[model samples]
Target: MGLPKRDQQYHTYADYLGWPESVRYELLDGVAFMMAGSDLAHQDIVGEVFAQLRNALQGKPCRPFVAPFDVRLPKPRQSDEQTDTVVQPDVMVVCDPAKIDRRGIRGAPDLIVEVLSPSTAGHDQVLKRRAYERAGVQEFWLVHPTDRVVTIYTLGQDGYGKPEIQELVGTTPVGVLENVEITWDELVARLPKIEY
Candidate 1:
């Protein structure tokens, strides 16, 4: 019912530029994957995380970004035409202003937060996680709305070490942002309750 599989060729940033502006997609290793729409719970978590990061980054050099903001991850010395990875993280923080441009972020953000959705859980947890680690993202947070938990990964000399797990019932400081703390209870309180 859609385009032929044969026509679905490996895509690059140049090809990404030609897609319909209304739809959202991510290019991972030259393969284009359509992005799924976010549910209310997913959006709520993203908003809360973004708000917390935005508040903490006020007056600081680092800035926070929400989804639909393209993050082009190009390999060393590769041109945009030769590069092929692009992702729109649920929430991202970038300290280097030089990386921001008219198209989007040209490099990896300092921190990336992904709010899990059933359709995207695997991609976010595995493929994207490995990609972020490879891109040298300093910190990564996987927020699970259903489980009400947040798993944090911090990169070290070797790579990302074991994750720090925290439930969404207490305050936890962001590992990458100094003096930034998020009160999970407050965030949880604002979320809609699910009735079993």
Candidate 2:
């Protein structure tokens, strides 16, 4: 199915909190973006990665959260219902306790992960990259299940810096998150083969 049309109006996290769960969306630069669902392989990949991150983060100060969790970016002086924009990142880690809110995360997360699908590949690479950068997210990971590759992008002064691509040939270190590493083979083993 296609995404919802642009409403030509900007919204905040509070506005999104009132939205129905049927409408999947992400807010970027004051615009609402409908996030498309992914295929089985895509979801499996994300689940595997999320599981790994969760297991590894045990005992650490960081906490891992899966999608469908609202991540709100609030505009200045805006009420929760007025300027709060809620997004569901595939995976995220919140290191700061203060940013956690009853509505969701109100600021940039320590790490954000997006599993790429055909329709969203470009948006994740470019559009979402810019948005996450502008939001000051420390790390972003783009997972391409078809290619059996994962690209880790860390936030830099200008924007998201060059990505480190790890092919599914062997163990690949996730350089962005400290003390965390995973292999392409490990990630690939979690998903069924793509028939197409």
lDDT of 2 by residue, 45-136 (tens): 77877788888889988888998887775556655566534568898999898988776787789888898887888777887777677778
| lDDT (0 to 1) per candidate | 0.86, 0.75
lDDT of 1 by residue, 39-65 (tens): 888887888889988988999999999
Which portions of model 2 miss their true places by more than 4 Å? 1-3, 75-85, 190-192
Name the top lDDT candidate.
1
Backbone clashes counted, model 1: 0
Specify the highest-TM-score model's number. 1
Residues forming the 10-long window of minimal summed lDDT in candidate 1: 1-10
